[model samples]
Target: MTLRIRHLRMRAKTPAGPYGADIRFASGLNVIWADNTKGKSTCMQGMLYALGLERMLSPRREVPLPHAMTSFLKNDDETQLNVLESTVSLEIENGAKQVITVHRSIKNALVDNRLISVDFGPTLTDKTVRTERRNFFVVDGGAAKREDGFHHFLEQFLGWQLPLVRRYEGSDCKLYLETIFPLFWVEHDVPPKFHPAAS
Candidate 1:
């Protein structure tokens, strides 16, 4: 399925104007370029924010949530309102063209309800392969653990659960990576054209 998000603010919401919180997303391959501080990454962030990734948020002045460190910088309260409103619109499913829109202020738990179903646990098991590749695993959240990447440790507390996801396809696969931080995060800087065929 293809996804798209629009109208999210990092520092502040879009000004009331002709194009409030304007953004466009393209399927297949999409690349954006611009000068520094021109909201290039911020635009991408808007989509991530709408997708419900907590740590990806830029942070408001105060109001903290679990694992979220609130900004405590001293500021003139009466003259400063740092609250930011963001809108996210996305299309899910390959060609279904279903669009959903969301608008809200920043919060500590900055993730979507459906996306929040990912879980990570150390004792998870798999269907086959003898369970020897004890890579710290992630399932759905709320029902499991957070803090991804088990860090390649000795057999003391590390063990394999085998990927419940056999081939890493569909929503089950996406949930697995989202909870444990997708492998793509490490390859974010790699150009797609230069990708190699390796495990």
Candidate 2:
């Protein structure tokens, strides 16, 4: 299925003030460009984080965002402001024209990071969509196959029936999203490798 990201937003509450970014994409190709350390990578990471795909970047359960998101952010005056809480939302559209908005808390006192809320409409783009909300869990066992699992819900939304693959122990397990995503998404932080041709 063709899945496209329609919008992405990252918000962080800080003592100095609120800091964040909101980006909207069109139907076709979209590119983000900015100067160094201007949150270009942060936006990309936020999208993955909101969709519970942060594990594509690492095997650790830790938040993949920079300190600006987890701890503090610097203002235009170069003063560091403590971040109280942070959240990210991603709006996406499937090939069938179905839209959904995913909300996740990256760092918050009240909300658990493992909980992901899904709105069954383009709530981020349209205010009157009357979207239905559902919650799912991630990072726990059976998250990829369980009914209440975020990845399982995501696979259904994308119309994907992942096949089981043989593991090292000769046991079969469904191909996890962590394994499939790397084939489609190229990370900005990892450098490319070059190998010489055999003589």
Candidate 3:
């Protein structure tokens, strides 16, 4: 794969202040290590969300992040702050050396959650680069196949020509990213829930 992930950013606006995290990846293998529930999963989820690939995790369009990203954020002092808005952005480059930043709103007043904005250059890293912004839709019908879809945009960016596959229904269908992604990416199952009776 010629795709290189440059950066991932998650930000939230709160009355107390802004709570956010930024992660930059190196050229080679990248590893994220943190204690349980310390946002190791959140960073991965944020990248998926920014790329409009969250549907691979669920069919529902609801935000998959925890309350810390959607409803509230806790400060270092343990004070709770109400989150007014939250967003995630991922910077990526293809084999052609084309760099673009993809951004999505988790919860915001002005932007719809289903809308994704793409910058032509590395807006997160270099402010001097003048780039055009384009908007695309996800989670709705035909998002992967339609011309205006985010996945279609991504496929063009990555120079992918998905092949037709024979489904069980005896019909040919284009192999989607959700199906191909699992070959390389594996998302862990959620921790088992507690049950008093089982225990």
The TM-score values for the models, in the order shown, are 0.38, 0.92, 0.89
The TM-score between candidate 3 and the true structure equals: 0.89
Q: Rank the candidates by TM-score, best first.
A: 2, 3, 1
User: CA lDDT, every prediction?
Assistant: 0.33, 0.90, 0.87
Which consecutive 10 residues in model 3 have the weakest lDDT in total?
Answer: 184-193
Number of the predicted model whose TM-score against the real structure is largest: 2
Candidate RMSDs in Å, in order, are 16.4, 5.4, 4.9
Segments in model 2 whose C-alpha atoms lie over 4 Å from true places: 187-199
Task: Write one digit per residue (lDDT tens) for candidate 2, span 46-88.
Answer: 9888888888877898999998899999988999899999999
Q: Which digits, one per residue and each the tens of the lDDT, describe model 1 over residues 1-199? A: 2233322323333222112234444455556665654456545554444344434343342222211112211122433333333333322222234332333234334643223221122111212322222123212333233343221111112232325454535444212323454433331333346677899
- Per residue, candidate 3 scores C-alpha lDDT tens digits across 25-113 of 99998888766777888888888888888877787768888888999877778898999999999999999999999999999988888
What candidate 3 gets wrong by more than 4 Å, as runs, is: 187-199
Clashing pairs in 3: none
